[model samples]
Target: MATQYANDIPFSASHDQQAFKLLELPPELLSLLESEHPPTLTITSSKATETTSGYALLCHGDKKYQMRQKNTSNPIMILAPSRTMPTESDDAETFISSPSVTTISKIEDTIELILQEAEVKAAPKNKWHEKFAKSRAEKKK
Candidate 1:
């Protein structure tokens, strides 16, 4: 393999860090996304209860997939590149152009989707009697 090296160009990290999430889509999820008019997916977390620590899930339509964050030893960075135009020097004698890249965000972990059973569960029944419930009827005088 031939190796070529280019001159070092300056790259800077942004002052403000924007935390980014990396999601690894599974095959089932990929197919859903490729289909026409893909359903909207949402990330939701369950409230922490006495039995379980809060867990997150990726919801696609009525289907829900368990989302797990796996930490990585190396950090993944998202960068934006720009080519700066040549500007006049302090002495106004020369023009300097710098092509640079900026690190806009960093991701340390990735979210993995665990495929859950995609069963079409029955729609939930609404308790109409519970809402606007009637008070107890009065006894006969």
Candidate 2:
């Protein structure tokens, strides 16, 4: 005979969905994250240009990858776990068994990363701090 566990909780999905986007990490990113010491990743976007609106890029140290926004028909949901506490309203000996989970949000699209080439890197004005500092120095002069 199999034993039944009494610690089962309920799960629910929220009708109201929050706005959220998911970034699909590349293989190189996965390896970097799995490494002993992971480097911080930065996401930077370009200003609107005459030819194009703009684009985003993800930076990993010296290397950079273009971030492309893509839409999908499939919905991706983000779930949140609900916490429980023992109730003593009737005092018949009731306790919270397990944590219940709920769906908190749904994602509309995903961001894909593409490795940026040397020529591609030259276009956008990056290293924002350097530009700001140079402007300040020029103003001071």
Candidate 3:
């Protein structure tokens, strides 16, 4: 029978400590959290686990929201108000104001309008066929 030694088991607590540290909210996010006051928002940096890729956690009361970066190299910031629910946690004192449906709809409409404007601005000024025709006419002259 082979004797198993304790040293054979690779047990280290450093990884957990590092993961906890990684989850610490950044100062910029904290400032935004204070300014926005979205009922409750807790931002945390996540490490890739077995099931999913690394993502940021945005907790609003008892409800949890995960924010996955579309591009690992460049991450975009998104701010959205969330409804708060009472929880039996130490941070239960945090309260959030819910926006009315009308307000949300107006915001959505404004965003759609802005996106339409941007699309219009980004469209090509001259069509390829038009340019080709103009060049052909010039060559004929």
Which is the leading candidate under TM-score?
1
For model 1, residues 1-141, the per-residue Cα lDDT tens digits are 544545677778888979788989988789879999888988898567788797887887777888988999999999999655554544444646578898998899998988668655769988776553543222221
- C-alpha lDDT values of all predictions: 0.78, 0.80, 0.42
Cand. 3 TM to true fold? 0.21
Pairs of residues at least 3 apart in sequence or in different chains that clash in candidate 1: none
Off by over 4 Å in 3: 1-38, 70-141
- Higher-lDDT candidate of 1 and 2: 2
Tens-digit lDDT string for candidate 2 (14-129): 88867787878889888998899999999888678789887888888887888888988987879898765455664446554567888889787898888877654456767899
Model 3 global lDDT (CA atoms, 0 to 1)? 0.42
**Candidate 1: where are CA atoms >4 Å away?**
1-6, 45-50, 84-93, 118-141
Candidate 3, after superposition: displacement of residue 7 in Å?
A: 80
Q: Give the number of colliding residue pairs in candidate 3.
A: 1
Q: Report the CA-based lDDT of candidate 1 relative to the real structure.
A: 0.78
Poorest 10 consecutive residues by lDDT, candidate 2: 89-98
Q: What's the C-alpha lDDT at position 58 in model 1?
A: 82
Find the 10 residues in a row with the least total lDDT in model 3.
106-115
